[model samples]
Target: MQSTPSYLWSTEDLLGQGATASVYKARNKKSGELVAVKVFNNASYLRPQEVQMREFEMLRKLNHKNIVKLFAVEETGSSKQKVLVMEYCSSGSLLNVLEEPANAFGLAESEFLIVLQCVVAGMNHLRENGVVHRDIKPGNIMRLVGEDGRSIYKLTDFGAARELEDDEKFVSVYGTEEYLHPDVYERAVLRKPQQKAFGVTVDLWSIGVTFYHAATGSLPFVPFGGPRRNKEIMYKITTEKPPGAIAGIQRQENGSIEWSYELPITCRLSAGLKDQLIPILANILEVDQEKCWGFDQFFAGTNDILHRIVVDVFSLQQASSHRIYIHSYNTTTMFLDAVFKQTNIVPHHQEYFFEGHLYELDPNLQARHFCRTTESSPLTLLSTSEQPEDVVGVQYRDPALDFPKLVPRVDVVADCSAAKSAVGAAHQTLRVGQALRRGRELLARGLHWVIGNLRTECSRILEQRRGAHSVLACLQLTEGRTHVLCEAVPAGGRAPAGLDVLRTRLRRVDEELSQCSRSIFDFQGALDGILAELAKDGQQVHEDKSIQQIECCLEKMQVIYKQFKRARTCLRLGYNEEQIHKLDKLNLGSLARRVLSIFQNGCVQQYQEALALHSSRMRKVCEIKKHLKRLSNRISSCSVEMMECQDCLQGALDRLLQTENWDLAAAPPAPSPVPLSQARQEMVLGMQELLEQMRSVTCDLQLNNSIIERLGGAAPTPSV
Candidate 1:
C-alpha cells in the first residue's frame, strides 16, 4: 500500500469516479483556484508502472487551449496515493450537456460551432504532439463557460491516450465501444482474430461518432437489443455499409433496422450548415480507413466554415429585436453599409454605436472583432445629422419571439401501455398534466414576446409620426427659405455675385432635408416610405411556421392526454390565429396613419425626380438628396441656371396630378382598416383572455396534481 502525501488542495465534492480513480472538485489552498483532483486507488497503482505513468507523462507534455491544463501531481492527504490536479470545468462535460432535454434534438447552431472548434483544435493538438487520444468521446471533453460567456471545451482524461506518430501503428486498442473504429472494435471488444494494427486514424472514427452525437443527440449505428446484446450486428452496420455512407442505423418497431445518412428534421443545424458538415462526417466516418481525412484536411474544411460565418447582429433591444447578418470581415464603416441595406439609412449618415461606447469610426475594425461567435450586439442606425435614431428605425424580431422552446415531451406512448392499473393511469395523467402546464408557461412566454413587440412597434410608430411632423414643419420652413433665396440670387452661381450666400443657404436647406430623408424619407414620400418600413417591420411576424408547429404539438398533446385520461386545462391556452396576429399589431393611431397616407398619395415620386434633377444637374444632392427638396419657388429670373434649378418647384407642381394616374382606372375604395386603437384594445383584451385562461389552467393543474398525489402518483416518472 502507498503512503498518502500532504495535500495543497481541499477535496470535498466528488466530481466523478472510474475504475482507476475518483475525481473530486478541489480548491487550491493558497491560490483559491478551483481544480479537479483525480486520486488513484491502490488497485490503479497495482497495474504495471509503465501503464500507470503513461497518462501522467502524456498529459504533462500537452499544452493547448482546447486541452485541459495540468496544474500539479500530488497525493491524497488521507490515502497517500498519487492524485492529479487539473483544470476544473464548472459547466461539466459535453455528454452532460447532450443529456439535457433541450439538447435531445442536438445543440443549437451556435453551440455546435463551439464544439467543432474546440474538438478540432484539441485533436489537432494531439496529432501535432504525436499523441493519439484513443478515446475521443463527449464524456472525455470538459466544458466551462469562459469569462467571455462562450463555452470553452477542453479535452481531458488521457488514460487511453499514447504517443504515436501519424504513420506508426499501436497494437493495443483503447476506447469506448460505441465510438471505436470498426477495425479496433472487432479485435478489442468482439475478440475476433485480426492482424491489423490501430493507428492515429482510430481517433478520427471516434471524432465522427462524437460529432454525430453532438449533432443528433444519438449514436450513428444501432441494432435490435442495442449494441451490447447485438454487438456483431452493430459492427456489421458500421463496417459493411458502403464507403462515405455516414449512415445512422436504428431498429424500427417491426424488427427492422433502417440506415440513413441524412440529418433528421429534429436536428437544429440548418440545411446550409449540414451541407458543409455532412461531407466532413462522411469523409471521417468512411468504413474504408484509407479515405478518411487527416488532421490538415480536416482543419482546412472547418477553417473555411469559421471564416465565412457572418455576425448576427441584433437591434436596439435583445429580447425583442431584429437579427441582421453581416459578413464577419466588414469594417465598422462596412457594418453600417450592411445595416443600410436593411434600414435604408445611407452609410455616411449612419453611426454604428453599441455596448455603451461609441466605437471609433475605425475603418479597419472588422465586425468579427466584436463577434467572437456568430451572434453579436443589436445593430442600431443612428443618423449623424438628427437626434439619435430611436427604436423607430430599429426592426425588432427574433426567432425566439415566434417560437416557444418547450421541454422535451415525456414518453406518454410507452406509459399508455401500462395504463390498465389506477396507479399507472394516474401517473400517466400526472405526467401529461405537468407537461401541459410547462407547455402553457412556454406559450405564455411566447405571448409576452408578442405583446412586447406590439407595444414596441406602437411606441416606434408614435415616435416616427412625431418626428415626421416635426421634420415636415421644418421642411415647410426650409421650402420658404429656398424660394426667397432663389429669387434673390441674380446669376444663380453663373456669376460670382451672392454665390457664397446662395451656397450657404443651399447647404443649410440641403442639410435639413438630408436629415429628414435619413430618418423617415421626405415629407412628400412619407406614406409609401412608412408602408415600406411597415412591411419591413412586420417581415418576421408573417413567418407563421412556428405557430403551425405549435398547433400540431398541441393536437398531439391532446391525443396523448386523451388516451390516459382527460384534463380539460391541458393544451387549452386559447391560442388561435387571431391572437397570433397580435404579434404584428401596432398602436400607431388610425388618424395619424391616414393623414400621412394622404400626403404621400401622388406627388412624392415627382418631387424626388425634380429634387434628383436639381441634384444631378447642379451637383446639389440629401446625400444632402440622402442631400435637397420641397422648394416652393416662383423664380422670376430669366437666367438659364435659374430656370433649370426652378424645376425643383415647377416640376414638383406639374407632377402632382400624375400620381392618381398610378392607378389605371377608377378603383373602388378598399375597406378602411380597423381603427388602430380598436386593434390595440382587441390585442389587450386577447392578452387578458389568455392570461385568465392560463391562470385557470394553472389552478386546474394544481387540482390535477393534488388528485395525482392522492392516487400515489407523486413519484417522478422516468423521462423519455
Candidate 2:
C-alpha cells in the first residue's frame, strides 16, 4: 500500500513478496519501461543493509544474458527504504515452473538441459569475475521468455554473493539451509578449525542438487522434521550418495526396516540416459569440494545430449551437400528416415556410404557409435546401380593427366527460366541470411567488449575513489594532529600564522575532496543504470538503425567515462597536494612524489589494459565481417551451380518422358536412343538430388532467421 519510489510508477499488480522485500510490477517513469521494483522494508532488519549493498555491487558488475539485470536503485520515504528496479521476467522463477501441476513429473531431459546450461554459463561468468554465488537454488533461478519464444534461465537474488579471495576462507553461514554445503554447515555448528575453506565448488554442489530436483521433480535430500533437521540433512549431504543409488526400504508391520539396497529405478532414469548422466551427478554431488565437478567437467560429461550432432550428407551424382541435426542416441534407421524425409529418396533404391563402408540398417546400434567409429567422416549417398570402386576411380583421375579430350554433348528441352528464378531467389536468401548471421555475431562481440571495458573502467574508478577516501581519512587524522600541536604550543611563541592559514585551507580542500568522491560514487551508480539500459537495447537491436542507437549509447558512456576520469584526476591531484603539505610538516617531502607516482602508474596500467582489450575486440569484429562476406560469395556460387544442374536434369527428364507413355498400347517413338528404364531411374535420382538441395537451402534460411531472432533481431522475409 506504500507509495513506490518517485522514479518508478507502481502498477496495481504485486508480482510477489518475500519476508525482507515485496516485489511490485512497476515502470520506469523516464524510460517508460516495465520493471519489477523490489522494495525492502527498513524497519524489519531481516536482511542486513550490507547484504543488499553486496548484491547491488555484484549485479552492477555483471552484464550477461543469463543474469538478472539491475536497472536502478532508489531510496525513498522518511525511513529511506531501499528499492531495486530490475528487469521483469514474465515467466517467473524456475521454482514456479517446476511446481506447476503440468510439470510436476519433472521437465523432459532436453528442457532440463536447456535450463542447466544457462545456469552453468551464468555461474561460470560469475566465477570468472571472482564472485561466489553461495546461493544457487531453483528459487533463485528465474525463467525469462526470450524474443525467440525460448525459455532463458537467469540467476537472481545475489544477497549471499561475495567477492572471493584465493587465500581468504568463507566461514560465514549464509544461503538456504537445504542448499548449504556440508562443510559450511559443519563449520557453523561445530566451529571446527580443520574444516577446509569452501570456494566456487560449493556453488557447483548447489547446482547439482538443483539439477537433481529438476530432473526428478523431488529434492535428492529433503528436510523432514524436528529441531535436529539441519544436522540430519547436513549428515545426509556429507555421508550419503545420491538418491539414484538408494533403493526403497522394506518395513515390517511394526514399521521396522527389513531391507534396503541399491536400485537404479528409484530415480526414474531411463537406461539409455543413465550412463550419460550418473557420472555428472556423482561428480557434482561429491562430498569433497576438491573432487566436485566444475562447469567445464559438467559440460563435457553431458555434451553429447546437450548439443546436437551435425551430420553432413553428400549426394554422389547430384554433387549436392546437406547438413542435418540428429540426437546421438538415434539409431541408424532413424537417421536414415530423417534423411529420406528431406531428400524424398526411396530407401530400397538408395545406398548410404560413410568412411569407406556402406551404412548398415541396425536398429540396435546408436548413431553415436557410428559417428565415433567414423570420426564424423562425411557420408555419401549413391544410387543402387553405382559402385564405390567407380567413384574411387573418378576421384583418382585428373583431367590434366590427359590431353584435352572431346566429349559428346546431349541437348535436351527444359525450363531454364524457372531454374534461373529459383536460383536467384535462393541467392538473395543466402545474402540476407549471411548479413543476419554476421550482424548477430558482430553485435554479440561488440556487446561483450563493451561490457568488459565498462567493468574495467568502473573497477578502476572505484579503486581510485577508494584511494581518495583513504587520503581524505588521512588528511582528517593529520588535521587532528595539527590541532593537538596548535593546542600544545604555548601562546604563539613559535607557532607561525601561516600554519593556521594552511590548516584552514587543508580543511576546506578536504571538504571539496569529500564531495568529489561522493560524486564519483554517484556516477558509478548512474553508469550501472545506463549499462543496464544498454543491455536491454542490445537485446532488441533488430535493424541497422537499432544498432546505431546502441552505438550512440556506448558513445555517451565513453563521454561519461572521460568526465569521470577528469574529475578523479583533479581530486587525486588535490589529495596529493594535501598529503605533500602534511609530509612537508613531517620533513618527509621527498617521499610524497614517490607515493603519488605509484598510484599514477597503477591507473596508467589499467587504462592501457582496457585499451588493449578494446582494440582486440574491434579486430575480431572486422575479421568476422570479412569471413561472412566470403561465406556469402561461396553460397551464391553454390546456388548458381545447383541451378545449372537442375536445368540439365529437367531437360533430360523432358526428353525421356516425351518418348515414353503411361499406356503401353499408345506408346510413341523414342525422342532419343536412351533406354526407358535407365532414363526413368536417372530422372528419379536427379529429382531427389534437386529436392535435397532445395530443402537444405530452406533449412539454412530458417536457421539464420532463428539465430537472428535469438540475437534480438528481426527475421528477414523469405524470398521463396
Candidate 3:
C-alpha cells in the first residue's frame, strides 16, 4: 500500500462513535506522533461530493493554537473511507468535566479561563481565517488536565463550519440546532416573512451559549429536545434580553453568592474576582454580535481582563493594587490627580458613612455598594492601601493577596449610635441630626488631611530647588500637583495657595490646572443649581404628603359635619329634641373616636390602592417585554432572510470569479472578439454586477441592524 508524506495518521484504536462520525486514537508510524483520527460517516461524506470537498477545504485552511490541528488526509482505500487526522489531546471533552464540576474542578477561575481562552481562541481564529465554527459546545472542546490539575482546552469539530469568505455576506442554516444563532436559524427557516439575510455574527450567538455553560456549569438556554430542539430556544435566548450583567448582584442581599460550603480556592479568592467575572461573562453572552468582541478583539479584551484578575486577585500585592476608592457623589475633578497618576479607570465610589463619617465617591469605583441605598441598607467604601494585614481593629486586610475590605454595609448602620437609638426609640423615628453632625466632622478632617499632604509634598519639592531653572521647573510641577489636590478636597476647603497668585502662576505652568480650577467654579455653580432643584423637589414631596394629611383631616371633618347635620335633622323632625341637643354638644372624646374611624378607613384604602398600582405596573412591564420578544423574533427572521439573500448573491459571485480565473488560465492567449472573449466579458460584467448588488445588500443589512438596535432600546450603535 502506497502512502503520501501528508498521511501522518491512520485510524487504529476506536475512542468513541457519535451519530455522525467515529473518532479513534491513532499514531503516525512515520513521525511517531500520537493523533486523533476522525472518520466521517459514508452517508454524510459520499451523499454529496460537494460536502466532502467543502469540509476538506475548510479544515485545510484553519491553523490555530486553540483549534485542533488537521495534520493529514488519507485517500487510498477502494471503499474510499475518508479520514481527517488532527492533533490529539489527552483529556477527552468538556462535557465530562461539567458533569462533575464540584468534584473534579481544580479551581473555578482557572477552569473557566482555560475554557474561555481555548474556545475564544479557536472561534476568533476561525472568524479571522474566514470561517465560522457554527457548532460550538462542550463536546467539541477537548481538554487535557496537566500535572497541576489545570485544564487546557482545544476546540475540535469544524465539520459544521461555514466558510464566510466575505464579512458582509451571510450564510444560512449552517450550524447545530442547539447552538444555532436565533437570527440565522430564524432566517434559515423563514420565521419572519419579510426579513432577509444574516451574517458571520451567528458564531458569536453560539459562543454565548458556550460561555453560560463554562461559568455556572449549567446552560443559560437549555433545549428540552437536546441539540436538535434548540431552534426555538435559540430564538428566545438571542431575541430576548437575558438578565442584565448585574442581575445576580441585584437579586442577592449582600451581592455575594450563598454557597452551602465554600470551595477550596474560591474561599481564598478576592471579592473583585467574583464581581468581575459576572460583567465579563455578561459582555460575552450579549446577543448582539456587534457588541461582543470579534475574534481578535475578544482575545485582546480577554488578555486585559485576565491580567487585571491576576494582578488584583491572584498575584502578590504590589504598587498596582494600591487603588483609590471614591464615593458615588464624588466629582471627576476630585480624581483628576489619581487619573493622571495612572491609566484612567474611573475610580469606584459610593455615598456611605464609613467609621461614622459620610463620604461620596464615583459609583464606578464602588464594586460592592453601587446603586444600593435604603432604610435597611447603610453604606461603606472598600479602602485599598499599603496598610498592614494586622492593622489594629481592621476587619478586612488579606494576608495572602494583601487587600482591604470595608465592613459590610449592614454593620455600618447597626454599629452607629444614632441607628441604635432610632431602633430603641418608642416612636421608631430616625433622627439624622447626630449622624449629619458626625459626617460633617469627618469631611472636615479628610479635607485637612488632603491639604496637609499637598503642603508637605510642595514644600519638599520647592526646598530641593537650587537654581533659577530648577526653581521654575519645581514651581511648575508643584502647581500641577497642587491644583489636583484642591479639586479632590470638598467645597469651602482652602487650596494650597491663595486663589489670586495661584491662578496667574498656575495658568503658566499647565493650562489643564488653570482650566480645572475654572471648572471648579462651574461645578460650584452647578452644585448651587442642584441645591435649588433639590429644594424645589423637597417642597413638592412635602406638599404632597401634607395634602394627603389635610385630605385625611377633611375626610374626618366631613363625617362630623354629617353627624351634626343629622342631629339638626332630628331636631327639625321634633322626634327627639332632647337627644339631638345632647348629641350637638359632643365632647372631644366622642369627636376623636369618629375622626379616628374615618382616618383608619382612608389609610387602608391608600394601602390597597398602592398595591394595586404596583401590580398594574409590573404586569404592564411584562407585557411590553413579551411584545419586544415577538418583535425581536420578527427582526431576527428578517435578518436571516436578508443574510441568506446576501450569501446567495455572494456565493454566486464567488463561483463566477472562480470560473473566470479557471477560464483565464486555460484559454489560449486571447485576441479581441475571440471565441472565449464574449464569455469572459459576460463573467466580468457578472462580477461587476455582483459587486454592486453586494454593496446595496450590505447597506440594507446595516439599516436593518440599526432598526433592530433602536427597537431593542440599547445604546446607539457603537463604532464597529
Using lDDT, give the best candidate's number. Answer: 1
Cα shift from native, residue 644, model 1 (Å):
20
lDDT of 2 by residue, 383-444 (tens): 44322212111011111121111112211111122222222222222222332333333333
Better of 2 and 3 by TM-score: 2
RMSD of each: 26.1, 43.1, 37.2
The parts of candidate 3 lying over 4 Å away from their true place are: 1-13, 30-32, 76-78, 101-107, 145-150, 185-196, 223-234, 242-271, 288-297, 309-720
Against the true structure, whose TM-score is highest? 1
Better candidate by lDDT, 1 or 3: 1
**Between prediction 2 and prediction 3, which has the larger lDDT?**
2
Off by over 4 Å in 1: 1-12, 30-32, 77-79, 253-256, 311-720
Rank order (by lDDT, best first): 1, 2, 3
Higher-scoring candidate on lDDT, 1 or 2: 1
lDDT of 3 by residue, 100-216 (tens): 413121225556767777776677777677886667777888887768887778888867676775356554456555556666657654365545465665666577666656555
lDDT (Cα, tens digit) per residue for candidate 1, span 133-177: 998999899999988999999999998788999889888877889
